[model samples]
Target chain A: MKTILIVIFFLYSQVQSVEPDEILADQELENVARIIGKELRCLVCQNEDIENSNADIARDLRILVRNMLSEGKTKDEIISYIHSRYGDFVLFNPPVRFDTSLLWVLPVIFLMLLCYTFFRKKH
Target chain B: MKYFFLLIIMSSFGFMFYKGLKIDPSIVPSNLIDEETPNFQLKKVENYPLFDSKDLLKKEIKIVNFFATWCGPCKIEHPQLMELSSSFRIYGIAKKDNPQNITKWLKSYGNPFDKIGLDNDGISSIEWGVYGLPETFLINKDNKILYKHIGPIMKNDLEKINAFLK
Candidate 1:
């Protein structure tokens, strides 16, 4: 039991301490967690961010964020934590790369098509 | 003209989405719907016997509220709860709080609960699936939880609850 405790404690410390190499990983991931947390609305809370909410579930998620930070997890993994639980509604800034590509490009596409159509008519 | 049509559709979509956000997302369908009332006992502050959910069984609807003295939204939702007292049986679960503070808090505002139970440890709250303060549970005649509202009840919610009562 003592050996088990020592091993667990060792892992816990290893997980918590950011090595020099892990520093780059930590800062990058921590920044992402903070930004995503700002955007994702707390599901049970009325008008509160996941970071600011005092709800127990929010606290759990906050702990998850910090633990992931210590373990050297990335931005995508952090967003995925909230995404799996609460859905996209939690995200303040929706990811616009692929699934939401249309949302990002439709305006530019429409403008370009309009300009093209106008030029064609003149021709 | 085409851009104008696009603009109109997009704006309406945005408006509708924002309105939907305003609609309380707490009532989103959960599997826990229609579950049995979680076991809890609280010392009724009116100096009565210890009130438990099992004791409240009757052929009428009941409301269970979880509030704390420190919760600001609880204060805001107090009046709406008071209004519901006439229509249905409402019990208060003071989560992780002091009985004296709760009694004093209610006195300043006014007690809406028929039996306010002191949930001092909040262990009972976990069984009830309480995630935060100002939450409410609507139970049917059979003591089955029909709906759970996560935040403070507002005037519009009271109207909706009234409709359900009817």
Candidate 2:
């Protein structure tokens, strides 16, 4: 019984908010939509990716992604299309620009400081 | 020298944290500001004048308001829209709302829209990058989006809107 419950719980974790009608008929295209959906942040929910979010805006975005995919829009094209409309905020992975460079740079600097303090001679 | 370097890093992190605290994370700055309004054709709402991207090019500053009859904040901002309509052309996009309901709501609130468009499926709202109801965008004479207000426009917001108009 415990093993069955664990299997059920594992299956539940795999469930997503993509409705039946929203899924593309083409298997390859549906995979692309799923991948893109995971990368795009739901603007309304803020933290959750559109693939998992149940927000109204997330549903709209999910349909939009499928529509764009069915229309033969490439993955990059679809992502950029939404990005151009909603800006960097919609992207889960922020582009490294001058404004956001600190996010990438600060971590490396902190790591270097830790290594130096830990490995350096104490004399 | 080690102590000085550590202090510098700590102070920099402290300053960054202080700046981050002052920012309201909910307000996502619009990427469309200064960009030309996106192309869209909204169906006419009831008997109101039709609105489209071409209407945005006219030689006058205009306001594009994304609202819904179901949204409570839209009703709250209705009075401000009425006041603003006296000075600027206000275009309304009723997102995913029934035309009859919109007509009744307008009658009750007193219509402030110079032209009202029906965004029946909400595609137009997506084109405008609207994630929430009662979003307002101020467009300049050249059709560039000048400013965007996310929520209901309250009494105090009038000054900011007026300043943007100038």
Candidate 3:
């Protein structure tokens, strides 16, 4: 019973929103689509990735990603295409531009300060 | 001096969080503003003539709205849209909606669109980077998208829309 429950939990957690019709026949291409989908933010949901979102836009994006992959577009090219259309908000990991540099640096700065404050007190 | 630096850093972070709290994260800014409108030629929902993006460039300014029959907010926005129609060249794109339903809905709600495009596949909405229904885009004669308003347009938004149209 415990083993069965664990299996059920695993399957439930792994469930994705990719509909059967959207799946590509080529396994390699499908893998690429999955990777791309995981990276693209669902514009409607804002917090969820397109791969697991049930929003209509997310479904459109998943289909678009699969189509692009089948058309022989590279992963970076696909990402750039989406980024160009949707802007920085569509990216789960925002690019380090001048404005975004502070976002990337501040966490490190905070960590360094915490370490310095702790070590200096001990010494 | 070190304590003062820590205080400044903590205060700045606090200030940033306070400002961030005021912003609604769901309202992502459109990248298409000031850029050329995405070219599309969709069949009219009922009228024989198709809606070509080229036609939008002929006017001084135009409004293109993405709506669906099933959307509740779109129904709410219809009357205000009708009020704006007399002054603006407002075009509609019925996203993934049946023509029959749209025709029926228009008849019941009152038709505000100068031209209604049928976006059955929703490809046009994707090209426009439309994530939500009842989104409106204002474009100039140059085909540049001047503004994009997501969700339902309210009374306050009319002032802004008028400013752009003017």
Candidate 4:
């Protein structure tokens, strides 16, 4: 019974915010949508990706992604389209622009500083 | 030297906190700023004629406010909106709201909108990239989006909006 429950929970985790009607007929396209959706953050929910968010805007974005896929748009094109409209806030991993470069580089610099401090010889 | 380094780290955090306190998180910067406004067509809430984005191009500058009857922040900004309407051409977009509720809300709160559009499906709001209710967009004469306000309009916000108009 425990094994069965575990299997059921695993299966349930696959069910995301995408509604039955929103699924693309093409399995290949649907897979692409899932991959892209995981990368896109839900602006309203902030922390949750649009793929997992139940927010109305998330649903709209999901539909939009599918529509763009069916229209033969590449993943990059679809992502860029939404990014242009919503800005860097919609992207979970925002591009390393002038203003956002610090966000991406700070952790690496911090780690390097820590390593240098730890490795430095005692005077 | 270690104590001096610690002091620098601690002061940096303190400075960050001080700056964070000065900024309002609710006011998210819009990507549409200085970009052309997205085109949309919405039916008027009343017996008025259809309103389109093209109509706004004729004006030197205008305000496109996204609101709803169900939104609390929208109510807080109502009187301020009414005050703004007297001086500026403010077009309101009602998101996913019942027409009757909007009509009633307008009656009670006092209608401040010069032109009101009923966005029953919320597609237009999505096109405008609205994060939440009570978002306002300032559009320039060239159809470019000038600025965006994300929350209820406060007294300081009124001054800022007025400054932009000038």
Cα lDDT over the full model 3: 0.88
Comparing only chain B with the true structure, the TM-scores of all models are: 0.78, 0.96, 0.94, 0.83
Q: Residue by residue across A21-114, what tens digits does model 2's lDDT show?
A: 8888899999999999999998988789999999888889889999988888999999998898889999999999999999999999999998
Could you arrange the candidates by DockQ from highest to lowest?
3, 2, 4, 1
Ten-residue segment with the worst summed lDDT in candidate 3 chain B?
B43-52
lDDT of 4 by residue, A1-123 (tens): 999999999988765888899899999999999999998988877688999999988888888898889999999999998898888888888998899887877677668767767777443
Worst 10 residues of 3 chain A by lDDT: A7-16
TM-score head-to-head 1 vs 4, winner: 4
Tell me the DockQ of each model, to 2 decimals.
0.12, 0.69, 0.73, 0.50
What TM-score, over all chains together, does every model reach? 0.52, 0.95, 0.94, 0.85
Pairwise TM-score winner, candidates 1 and 2: 2
Q: Which candidate is the best by TM-score?
A: 2
Off by over 4 Å in 3: A1-13
In candidate 3, the residue pairs with backbone N, CA or C atoms under 3 Å apart (3 or more residues apart, or in different chains) clash, namely none
After the best TM-score superposition of candidate 3, give how far the Cα of residue A22 lies from its true spot, in angstroms.
Answer: 0.7
- Residue pairs in collision within model 4: none
RMSD per prediction, one decimal?
Answer: 12.0, 2.0, 2.1, 3.3
lDDT of residue B96 for candidate 4: 86
Choose the strongest candidate by DockQ.
Answer: 3
TM-score of 2: 0.95
